[model samples]
Target: MNRSDMNNMAGSPYLLWRVGSLGLLAVVACVLAIRSFSPTARTRQGLMLAWAVAVVAIAASAFVVPEGVSDRALLNRIDPASGVKCATSIFVLSLPIVALLGALMGRAAPTQPRLSALASGIAAGACGAFVFAFCCPFNDPLYVVVWYSVGCAAVAGAARWRLPRRFRL
Candidate 1:
């Protein structure tokens, strides 16, 4: 609507990516929550749907990385020490929430515990990463790829590991 606002948006190309990525993640999380918790036939169709959601989430998150940046440049910008810390912290913070959601869903769907757990894990990871994108000022493609995405995945893995113990009826 205004020139200054337009200028700011133009300067921050990653804003578009952030908005789109978060929107996509939100949708994926909801879809996963619904399908994963529902009692359905443990068939190939269901598994394929889960795989599709996972793949879409991964691909969408990857696109959050800026384009036209060379690998060398990205690598040079990487701060492995800080990145690890950031990723770890985000994952650790998100795990409990993810675990709680998984547990609630798992109680209802005892037929396919693994599938439900996987869906919840992936959804939780996406949700966590999306939230991180807002606070993280760094729009470096490498940072988004390495820490944010990996953080989501780490949360997912941790959730999966804790699935049986916490979700068991």
Candidate 2:
């Protein structure tokens, strides 16, 4: 996008409203999965619920992007490094949450410590991404999926490696 386009959308309430609402929806679902999965129950319901929310979020993103614009075109709006910025932001905020969740899971005695901590880390990453959405100017669908997904995976990987070692079982 050009200067005028950037200026126009920079403070667009519609963009904020859409991203905020849907982003929170995604985060909440992930959190629910984390909450349920951390316990010993290990039911599939919570994970499935989170997956359903993810599907809805992905479908909604098609609408979020401007009609008829290619994914590459969307990056011109501002900050070619927006994906990296967003991803870094995700780590900064989510790491603490992941640690907290991991600590909780350790105390709760999950059936599989590593797996449970990893899942909770993913949810924590989503929570951080949701919080950063307000500050991240880039609203492209590709940017959201690629960088956010990376951030989640990175956190989850770290949690899997770190959290399991803390447990006795």
| Clash count list over all predictions | 0, 1
lDDT of 1 by residue, 65-110 (tens): 5555445565565677778876876686677668677668756764
TM-score of 2: 0.74
Where in model 1 is the C-alpha error above 4 Å? 1-11, 41-72, 166-169
Q: Which candidate is the best by lDDT?
A: 2
Error of 2 at 16 (Å): 5.3
lDDT of each: 0.63, 0.65
RMSD from true fold, candidate 2: 4.5
lDDT score for residue 59 of model 1: 63
TM-score of 1: 0.71
Error of 1 at 49 (Å): 5.6
Q: Where is model 2 more than 4 Å wrong at Cα?
A: 1-34, 37-39, 43-45, 71-80
Every model's Cα RMSD, please?
5.0, 4.5
